[model samples]
Target: MAPKTIIQQESLLQYQCELGEGSLWDAVRQRLYFVDILGCKIFTYEPSTGKHGYQSFDRNVTALALLEDNTGLLAALQDGLAFISFDQLPFPPTNSPSTYKRLNVDITHLEGFNRFNEACVDPSGKRWIVGTMMHEQGFPGSAGGGLYSISKSGDGLTAELLLDQLTVSNGMGWTKYNKTMYFTDSLRKEIGKYDYDIDTGAVSNKVIFSNVDDEELGVPDGMCQDDQYGIWSARWGSGKVIRFTPQGEIDLIVHLPQALNVTSCIFGGPNLDELYVTSAREGTTAEQIKRHPSNGDLFVVKGLGFRGKERTRFQGSFLA
Candidate 1:
């Protein structure tokens, strides 16, 4: 067997967000989008121009899905989902909030003290899967954080509950064949696999894909899969990312020394060989922040000899 190759990680940006998550890359426009959950902001970056900017929101924005038409982003906000067009950036272009319209689907029934956490578009581009977690004091699977599915078609947006009893529903990814779906419940410290149906976007046969000891490897957060089906998991407290095979075998690990909280990650760059990482500065003391200044910054890993799949866009007329 050939020797293992070491991947190099470097800080790409220095914008310290309180809780940065969800990194999505738009290949056609060559732009990268991410969110600062605690800071209540969404960020955009252009590598060619070396420009980094953000847009503020009244509520926490957890995740974002690139629109199929590449015109805007589908945002999972504190109240519900919304469509944010690119034309209103830098400023709203107008003082009116009409540029950011919340969908008709109401998630307040599902969110008691918690809000939407992490979300992604399904491989078919027709279904958007979002997960939530308890924002206050509670153990894992407590406070009624659950998984939800929002079907988007020409008709409109409709929401449905899929699973309940979760503390922090984090990373999610699907196998290349779209037959297996992997989901991470951070509080449970386990990644669960489900038999997935591409036609209906239904999942069943839930089983354990991998388990992490919080004290040992840290809680599993955001995740993405490479073209080879290797699942790359961003570890929260451990400040690292681990690569595992579909069978749950550890293959490689990438460590970020400049960060204390590794929130999420995604594959980007021209060829999708680059891994963009996001971290958090929340719950840290000023002293700790002084020590690690890049805590809430964005980083990237390149020269990994691996490439990741392009993010699936949401195919919905709601944003049209």
Candidate 2:
């Protein structure tokens, strides 16, 4: 067995978050975005100018994706999806009533403790795939969560349920060719691979791509793929971001010593050679928090000698 390559990480932002997830890189704007689910905040940071800001909301803002044509951002709130124009939001954002244009998608079926989780855009930028999870932790197969794909249908938006019975539908990404798709069900402790059809926005031939049987290594949370077909998955409780080969083999692990609950990661920076990671301090004990003071801070891993493809933006139309 080849030895696992270990890499060190550095803190990028000291802004504390209860549950910092949904790492995204807007290549066109050269900025990074992420969300604090429990904090109800969406943060933005420009690497070039060191200008960091955030927009707070009354409800949980779990995930975000850039919109095509630079219209704005597609945000996954607690109940449903919405559109937020960054140009309209103030710099050094305030906790004003969220200025998002809520999309007309019926999510009342996901009542009770269920809420939106991770979301991503298809490689072609034609569809938005978002997942749901129960607010409280439930056993595998116990939670009635699901994954859905949203697209523009004529003048309005339509949502198609793709997968159901998920405990925690988390990260998702596509291959460079858009022929393969990867998704993570955190409580299942595995990542699934599927045959992807970009034209039809469908996934089939689902199979377990990687399974983390060791509890100490933590479950797979959020992930992004590289140009070389490596899946970089953030391990929730292990303070590690692992890189798995296309064949489901571990090739590299990036360690963030101060972050025990690593949430998500994405590639950014001028050359796209850097990896930006988000962490959580939500479920930590007082002692654990004391030990890892920067548990909820964002971090970056550099000098990996590899890069990722630019993420696609949501091309769907917004509600008037």
Candidate 3:
């Protein structure tokens, strides 16, 4: 096996965020879009100009995916999934939802599902999201809480049980070749891979792909895949991310400077060789908050590679 490594180049600067979690690579706009749920904000990183822009949300802005058109966004707002524009999202690039009531209809009913933890779009355009019962990695699962999905149409969304119980449903990635779907229930210390049926967006035949039993080292959180089929999982308590393959093969692990609960990672920079990471500090003590000053910050490492396509929302499969 190849040894663990870090990419050595950076084309942009690291920015501190309050609770940075989701890291979406916007291929159309050539920017890194992420959210700080506890801070209730959205951030846009423009590498070309070194400009970091932000928008504050009313509740939590959990996850974000760019529409196929490249100019809009599919936001997993605290209220629900909204065809939103942050600057002016729904339509007209000017009309915005003023109240949680007027926000995405789906969320209006499921706001209680969770603050919306992590999500990914399937090949059919359905939005698959997990409501973190615990919300935070180490916390316990909320009763009756689990996974959910919003159909491709503009109408109905459904809450289903991917698992009866879960703490943080974070790691989600399509395989390098797009044949498998890997998901992590962070507190379970288990990473699972399911047989993915792209045509129907159904997942089944799940088998454990990796298991990290050390509570002190933390369980798995968000992750990304590379062309070599490497699964780099961010360990929520260990202050490191590890690599595994689709068949449950261990590859390597890269350590971070502190255990601020690494949240998610993605390959975004030019050439898809730079790995960007998101960290969190929502539950830290005052002392911990000070010791790991980079907590809830954005970090990057050079010299890694991935072949992931920005996923598409079926409705907006308008092809950007």
Best by TM-score: 2
- Give, for candidate 3, the lowest lDDT window spanning 10 residues: 89-98
Alpha-carbon lDDT, every model: 0.81, 0.84, 0.64
| TM-scores, all models, native as reference | 0.91, 0.93, 0.81
Which residue runs does candidate 1 get wrong by more than 4 Å? 1-10, 90-99, 106-108, 111-113, 153-155, 214-216
The digit string of per-residue lDDT tens for model 1 on 1-320 reads 32253443457898888899999888887778899998878888887777877877788889998888777888898768888877755431233333487877745444444788899888998889998877677553355688888886344577777777777888999987899889998878889999988898778899999887856467899998899989999888777888898778877888787787888988888899988999999877888777667889999888888898887898865544
**What's the distance in Å from true for residue 44, model 1?**
0.7
Best by lDDT: 2
Task: Give the Å error, residue 130, model 3.
Answer: 4.7
> Candidate 3: TM-score?
0.81
- The alpha-carbon lDDT assigned to residue 4 of candidate 3 equals 59
Candidate 1 Cα deviation (angstroms), residue 95: 11
Error of 3 at 152 (Å): 2.7
Model 3 per-residue lDDT tens digits across residues 1-320: 67555432221334556667788887656778788888876677777677775665677878776655554566666546655543442211122333322233333222224456777776555555444444343345343336665554444445544444556567777775557888887667888888877766667888888886876446787887776767888877656777776667666666665546778888787666667788887767889866666767777776544554444544543211
1-320: candidate 2 lDDT, tens digit per residue: 76376656458898878999998998987889898999988888899988888887879989888887687888888888888887645555666766788887754444324788899988888889999886565544356678888888776678887877677889898776889889998988989988988998878899999888876578899998888978999998888899988788887888887888999999999989899999999899999888778899999888887898788887765745
Residue 13 of candidate 1: its Cα lDDT? 91
| Model 1: how far residue 90 lies from native, Å | 5.0
